[model samples]
Target: MLEIGLTMKKLKLKESTCAICLTAMKAGQGHAIFTAECSHSFHFHCITSNVKHGNQICPVCRAKWKEIPFQNPASDISHGRQRINAVGWPRDDTWMTVLRRLPPARLDTNRHIPSLYHAQEPPIFDDDETLDQQHVIAERDVSIIDGVGDPNSVGTIEIKTYPEVSAVSRSASHDNFTVLIHLQAPVTSGRHSGSSNNAELPQMSQNSRASVDLVTVLDVSGSMAGTKLALLKRAMGFVIQNLGPSDRLSVIAFSSTARRLFPLRRMTEAGRQEALQAVNSLISNGGTNIAEGLRKSAKVIVDRKWKNSVASIILLSDGQDTYTVTSPNGTHPRADYKSLLPISIHQNRGTGCQIPVHSFGFGTDHDAASMHSISEISGGTFSFIEAEGVIQDAFAQCIGGLLSVVVQELQVKVECVHRNLHIGSIKAGSYRTSITGNARMGTVDVGDLYAEEERDFLVTINIPVDRSIDQMPLLKVGCVYREPITKDAVTLEGASQVWIQRPEIIGAQVVSMEVDRQRSRIHAAEAMAEARVAAENGDLARAVSVLESCYKSLSETASAQTGDRLCVALCAELKEMQERMANRQVYETSGRAYVLSGLSSHSWQRATARGDSTDSTSLVQAYQTPSMVDMVTRSQTMLLGNPSSHRKLRQALSFPAARPQPR
Candidate 1:
């Protein structure tokens, strides 16, 4: 047995108060004083209560608490008394060095001192400076200059438009072509310096990441016994460790019912420990109530009022929801599943911001269709974890993007400026698009964007033949978003505009490789969707044939372009799908879920780490190490352009290397 002792003395002060309870402490009263090593004083009862709750650090300064001492004023007074000499108490002029070395103080009445609280006026510019400021600006310039641009500007979300053919041949009939719109969020520097009025602004992160309010809904069903539950615990531990102090977290566990193990709290040292304790306490038993889990998770978010933070939910499950009633044949999930969706996903009624719920189907037994639908309805992505030990990597990839969000409420709009131009169709995967004005205007709701994240939309335009006009306005593209740090709405317009040339002799038209690649991706997604439908209908042979045809087409495209990494990767995915569809047993077990999850990822334009892939390890490393941006980009190499194009993009963006911090 070990015993410890506390050494203490009576604290003497004119009027001292306890820091913990903020109550006055009087000598001879019943209150005891406890002092930590950092010299912060607190009431004995309050300090003891804090310690009982497993807080090993000082609440005031967040310093590690050493062995504290307890002091009693009455006992100290009885123990000893010290005497003071009075010989020099009234005559201590010898120590006054200031009076001997300096003259009397004087105030200068002519000097005008400005008020600290008053706002300063803008500086007047000379003619030369005005001329310099009036220089022509480039079409692609988006930098914010002090005193020259909007003072409230945080940064600009870049929008680039690429058409299949820059110049179309003039003909008597209307010509239709495809246009690709790419939107990328600005790279944050993690530090902002400006006027003193904005000094107290909240920073997203020291490493250029936005703060997040993440709620993790975990399944502790009977199907997750042994290895599955153990792996989940480990993956959750990794998640807890990676979150910064600015981020907030909540944990919900569900078996037959749902329970809030950890309430929404900042990811401080104590909070992380409490979250880990909650994760470790999870036990695998009872039926899976996924609806209850999602309901509880969304309630947690809806109850809390979060500001300037990215709010999201992450749900992990390994089995079907037990709340659904069986059909006549009992071979499929009944229509009752639809009733649980609205209850699972909750949107803020006041702000109208939809909280996305990213769902993870943990095993083959999980309901893939329901999981994918949950994510789709909530504007989130679905990931499939078909193998053990890969859950951590999947979670890391998801959380990594969440932590790096730089823009919110992103909206992209495209309009036909010419009277004859018309918008035909917009292909933006799973994103929602609205068209109005007789197909002359189209808008896509892009939601939030991560740092350096790229999203592309392909639009078909109907161009009318004009023989008289030399140049005609084609289309206008613009975007608007809320900056994460400042929460200011930034609108950018006229960034890209297309014009048609009507020359009698037309030059040879060059097709953009980027546009072609995106076209192929869209087609591939359609093929995958068709294959999934066939597989779901139990036509295994048809699914295999569809996959093989898509794979052959992608192979030919990849062969034509020597350095087309995305085409090659898509080919590989289709080939894998073919092999799995050919095997009836695999198709029934994990292949169906994998196909659905892949389709979800492609549609959402979010890359996920599939089972036991090399990219999974790279994604985990990206989350753990300092080269997050580089490593994450490499992990999603299939979405990147060719080597030269990628290099040019990096140079243009000029992302700074992140400094390493201790985990």
Candidate 2:
């Protein structure tokens, strides 16, 4: 339920406040306020903006509004976003909006199965029924393990029982594994419901169908060559073979420009074969222009039909891009290949397409960092391959990622039993819990839990529940799903029983991992830069130090391939710099090359101009490491293109009047 009222002044909220930190808003601080049918008030800013662009709901109250009513640009300019929420509509286009139109919550209409109960009884066992055939209900059981001191306890599965709907979701491995999940509520009455226990609910209730649109962007760059292209083709065949008939797939291959290998097509054996053959025909040629590929892929997914699906792109590449706007001398101007893809992805997702992207870096030359960012921006995955042989597996992994997105942009709203009760923040991911003691206490297990065949995904929710014991005990869960295209929202309500409270311990494991990964990448990039600078300044020791630092940091990264590549690249660059440092010491004397040290190039030039031949031998005698002649030859390899600098040092050795110009 939603209510909209023109506010002459400020709108006040009830017990509910900001989702980031549940607290009362201070005076003069502005926030969008929402009032639900239950008279629950929530700060509008807390729910709308705190969430992504497409999601619009009162996070505290679980009320949903529409978006089309507030599409007027003038109204937006005058009243701002506050008006959009007040009107019960999406303020802007986003993936969250698309998920909102999905099916609403529905209960199984079938007969009531026995609610298993064991107040204080021995272990209960039910093995006659299979997962597919058995109807789950609220129950408790304890198992006694032979030779063990204590019995192992298992909690009951209280799933709203429904008739099994046959569903065949495409598996990433191209295996023939398919299962149906509940999708719609069947009509049932008390007496009739009890009698018709076999009536099953639709797999994937209409509310959770999760409309999706997927686009495949394949790299046809020449570097992909024979084997890489063949593997990619085979992997693609597997992907098509595994998809559910209801799902859609599109393929786009790119070299310098994008070309559709197959327009948006439904999953069919014949269709899959045609697409596979098209992929095989895709000969690798020309340069890699990723921007063009993305634009074309976006155009296909933006269609109204694909909007029913979550828009997505799968990029396969084997090397870095070559042609693009570049400033050779600008600070960090090597073209942000990784940053560019995310920008494109975000823009498309904002336009009624919650399109996530997954990347398969097919070979060592590809930019792995860029692939990862592209995946993150679109809410997808990234994988690195060492050889063409792994292409099929890589493709399968990408398919798995797509299959895992059972739900998109799922937001949870929680209400506490007490007004003062504060709910701690919840991270995104699937959670598992056990109802204990006739009362229920909720303990969330956060992380991806694979469904029988679906891919894994990360999910987070902000619930209005208390973390500490000094507040309300009961916890209520509510949620809203934003449609990827329509910008509509479907609200849902759920709850857990109350029992003896047990503290749940969660560590900062993911946070630490992210930090470490970031630090290592930054360190490696900087160390390489520093080494180059040190060599330019003729500081061999500093150059060596920078390389060593980079080498150590790379070793600490999780992936050996990433670390090894950085180590190898930096070591080679450092070696060149070290050689230059040695050669810069050569000076001229008596028209013959002479080994020298300690004297700055400037000093050497000044001394030679004054005909001070004595300084040449003196400089040489100062260091016993190597002769000036020997250093000159060694440095030639290091400073091959730095002719001006090389000439100056050699001139200084003989005439003491030459100095190389700075590069």
Task: Using TM-score, give the best candidate's number.
Answer: 1
TM-score per prediction, in order, is 0.69, 0.39
**lDDT (C-alpha, whole model) for all candidates:** 0.62, 0.38
| Candidate 1 TM-score over all chains jointly | 0.69
Measured by TM-score, how close is model 2 to the native structure? 0.39
lDDT for model 1, please.
0.62
Most lDDT-accurate candidate: 1
Q: Which ten residues in a row have the lowest lDDT in candidate 2?
A: 133-142
Clashes of each: 0, 64
RMSD of each: 18.8, 34.0
For model 1, what is the alpha-carbon lDDT of residue 591? 80
For model 2, residues 1-663, the per-residue Cα lDDT tens digits are 323331222444333333222345443465444443323343544333334433333222223333311222233335344423332333332111221332322323452323122122112211111111111110011112221332221111111111111121211111211111111111111101111211221122212223234678888899976556645654665566545444567777888766765556545444444444455456789988766677667667654332343457888777665554346664321345455553546523213444656666665566544554455455454554443443444454344434433333443333444343333332222123333322222233211111111111111112233445432233454444442212344455552212122234323322222223323433444554465456546665676677666666566565333433323433433343334344343111111111011111111111101111322111211111111222222222111112222212212223111111111
N/CA/C clash count, model 2: 64
